[model samples]
Target: MADRLSQVSGHLTNSYGRGLLAGEVAIITGMCWRSWSGIGRSAALLFAKEGAKVVVSDLDEKKAQIVVDEIKAAGGDAIAVGGDVGADDFPQKVVDAATKKYGKINHIVNNAGFTFDRMLHTTPDDAWDVIQKIHVRAPFRLIRAAAPHMRFKVRRENRSVINVSSISGLHGNVGQANYATAKAAVVGLTKTVAKEWGGFGVRANTVAFGFVKTRLTQAKEEGASIEINGKKVALGIPGAKDDPNAQYPHIPLNRGASPDEAAAGILFLASPLASFVTGHTLEVTGGQGI
Candidate 1:
């Protein structure tokens, strides 16, 4: 009798809401930092909150462990693996470490990246190569490393890969030739991966974002930058104010999305809710890019 009453109440309202990813393990890359917290960190936190154990991969060991500690404090499961995505060995290292700890891989969110904006005339060979390696090559290798575990496994459920992109990739942005090229390349790669991996019940998709106020997009007045290898590059948009989107007169939503808001899009694609969604790009820009 009590169980029947509870069921009726649950139907009417919310019954403490079981998480959408109640039984999964996810690998999220590019999660780090003290001031420049971006979509990667937000997505990792949300995924863990949604009942998925997580592997927090980032360039900085200290910052990566910080995210893992936060997840554990919230009663969620997580571990940190620090390595440069641009390194040849890092992708496989991430996969090996994840499988050793979690036993299996269920989701891959390729969110590690940084923008090295430069005009076409001034774009150096090294600059272009770095962006491509981090944004394009890393995603390709990570997904490939995880594919063997996902494909032809009798007990495996549908697995997914979410490649993080930028609005600049969809609609070319000036002064960002290298950054834009790498991002755009991932979209094409994702579409191809979706087709080839579909037979194995694995899905591939992209999430392109507009102005979300991370250190990468914060106003220069905030003193935002990222140290790549050893060089400190100015890593943010200038003159957009603290709320980059709110200051924009053309944005449909009238404000920029918070990190959590941007993360919601990635979380959706990673969850079972998007099991049938592949080869698609979900723009979580609050209608900024149209």
Candidate 2:
């Protein structure tokens, strides 16, 4: 499955040998654990293959080290930095680590985030605050820290910022009020940062993803099979078990996207291909909302 997915990705980019991101350094957050491997790992590998050095950051040291090991085994340049995104000093720490190792920071992917399932009335205040801190506060702080570094790089080399948002933010989902609010704020941050930093050759944008198979989705699928809150809500579509294409019958594309597909969109926005693109939200949902 991994090999097949790689082939699909190679064909999708079609610029494997061009080195579009050559000499660049990208920091990817939320890249720990098997569930996040698809998007975060794929992005790290792809960036390296394109001649960019990578900084893989995650809250889980073990998982983050695994990603770094994989990249190194592939003969790519990378390092793992483990720290909680919700930490007050995490942003500065991330920037410091990236600069110390790579000597410069060029791109950032704000992807580290998760949310506990709870409806508004059922959510506790602590849970709401934690969700917001992780999803919104952390990303914004990281961008703020990276801004000056990016500016310095631009004076010497251009840079970009890719913030990961969600469809839940665009069209709210039940039991995701706090998560949605945080993600929506990310979109707003993306635009504002793009506008403020454009002159410095720093571009910012967001990627809003829909259903994608990951550890989180798998857990949700398992939980959905059993009754929750006195309701049997099917996490996955009825026929998705056998036919992957059956998952999104209502979507124009009729299927969910792979993590690599989402990563490709991030790469595009970060590359010269999107030199003039900023403050945009690229939906990697197979046309689900359209």
Tens digits of per-residue lDDT, candidate 1, 33-96, equal: 5666778889989998988889998898778899999999999999999989888899789999
Task: Per model, state how many residue pairs clash.
Answer: 0, 2
Error of 1 at 63 (Å): 0.8
Candidate 1, which ten residues in sequence have the lowest lDDT sum?
A: 7-16
TM-score of each: 0.91, 0.84
lDDT of 1 at 148: 80
Candidate achieving the largest TM-score: 1
RMSD of each: 5.0, 8.0
Worst 10 residues of 2 by lDDT: 233-242
lDDT of 2 by residue, 1-290 (tens): 79855654663365445587877899998773443345777788788878788999888777788888888888788988888887888899989999999888989999877656577999877667877888889888998887767765333254889999999899988888988898899999999989988888788989998876654455453444323235443343322343454545666887767778878888898886776689999998888777
**lDDT winner:** 1
